[model samples]
Target: MLQRSFYERPVIQVARELIGCYLVREIDGETLVGKIVETEAYAGPLDRAAHSYSNRPTERTKAMFQEAGHAYIYEMHTHALLNVVTGRVGQPHGVLIRAVEPIAGLEVMKQNRATVKRQIDWTNGPGKLTKAFHITKALYAHPLNERPLYIEEGEKGVKIARSPRVGIANSGRAADYPWRFFERGNPYVSTFRK
Candidate 1:
């Protein structure tokens, strides 16, 4: 599993390097794993697109300000979005896990995302990947270097693609920042492009 040092780096660097890592979750005696395909970096305070922009803190944004290697989960439109907190404590930096490619326990993922139009849709977006992986607010603020949920080492030589982050079009120049990273030509990446 990835250790604390893996996440205690600049949020932008952490986000870019996450493209080919493994996200692992174990629940109810079942294990599900996916290869991280896409991510969007939200640098703290200075990043207007960040939840903790300007150092603003709230009940929901608390996780983002915690030390690195924690899950910064939240709800939006009734769907859970998962983020990996990065940098040191009080930084509020994080990387939103935008997509993943199913690596194991696909049956469980299919059950979780049964209505998805295709197998590729099972984890082709932030909310979709959370549902497919059974991720929820219950994991919010939880450490990510341990059991139940953790990141594992994965392929190291993946070619990366970059683009503006999805949504938050009103965040001024922040909306145009090329902060999104993904595996080049990965079929599991989100269909939306900036």
Candidate 2:
């Protein structure tokens, strides 16, 4: 599992570095592992796309304010999305795991995402990945280095790629910021390069 120090850096840095790392989760005594492929950065209050922009305190964002390496989970469109808390406490920096490539426990992952017909579709997006791993709000604020859910180190030498974030058109220039990171040529990356 990755140590807390790995997530203590800036949110953008953590998001970029997460590429090729393994995201591990345990459900019903079965282990599920996926290689982190895509990520989007939401840096503190200054970044308008971030939930903590303007320092507007709210319960939904509470997990995002935790110290580095915590899980910040929320539900959207009835699908649970997972974000990794980064930076120091009160910073509210987060790295959204947009997509992952299945690494192990294929049977369990397929069962968890029973509705997905294609294997690649099972975890090609944030919501899809959470479902494939059975992740939910129950893991909110949980440490990323602990059991049930954690990140493992991956092999090096993978090429990293970045692009403007997706689905945030209303955030002005924030939408144009190249805050999304992914492994170059990785098929599991969400919203493939144009």
Candidate 3:
């Protein structure tokens, strides 16, 4: 598990470095693991696309204001999107976990995502990855180093690629910011790869 200091860095740095980290989920005694392949930085307060923009701390985004290394799950339509709260306590920065490559508990992940005709589709999107890992609102504000969900160190020499974040065309000039990062040629990366 990574220390709190690891997540207390700048949002963009955390997002980029998270590219090759391992996201682990333990549910019902089964351990599900995946290599994080895609991430997007949300520079809170000033980022129009971030839920914590304007320093607003509503019930849904209150976790964003918590200390770094906490889970900040939010709903998109009916699906839950998982984010890692980064930066200091009063800073609402975060890193959205967009996609992951399944590494362990493949059978359980397939069972969770029943329509997964191909392995890549199991975690190719934020919502899909959350579903496959059983992440939900219940995990909001949970510490990333604690039980059910946590992150572990992964390979050290991975090459990361950067691009504009996905689905935020209305964020003005922030929409063009190259805050999205992913493993260079990983097939399990999201379909929006650039």
Off by over 4 Å in 3: none
Cα distance off (Å), candidate 2, residue 147: 0.4
Residue-wise lDDT of candidate 2 within 1-194, one digit each (tens)?
Answer: 99999999988899999998999998788899999999999987978888888675589998887789999998999899999999998889999999999989899999988878999999999999999999999898999999989999996988998899878857878888899999999889886452
lDDT of each: 0.92, 0.91, 0.93
Span of 10 residues, lowest total lDDT, candidate 3: 185-194
lDDT of 3 by residue, 79-130 (tens): 8999999999989999999999999999999999997688889999999999
In candidate 2, stretches whose alpha carbon ends up further than 4 angstroms from where it belongs are 192-194
RMSD of each: 0.9, 1.3, 1.1
lDDT of 1 at 146: 88
lDDT of 1 at 70: 96
TM-score of each: 0.97, 0.97, 0.97
- Please list the residue runs of candidate 1 whose C-alpha ends up more than 4 Å from where it truly belongs after superposition: none
- Of the candidates numbered 1 and 2, which has the greater lDDT value? 1
Q: Judging by TM-score, tell me the better candidate of 2 and 3.
A: 3
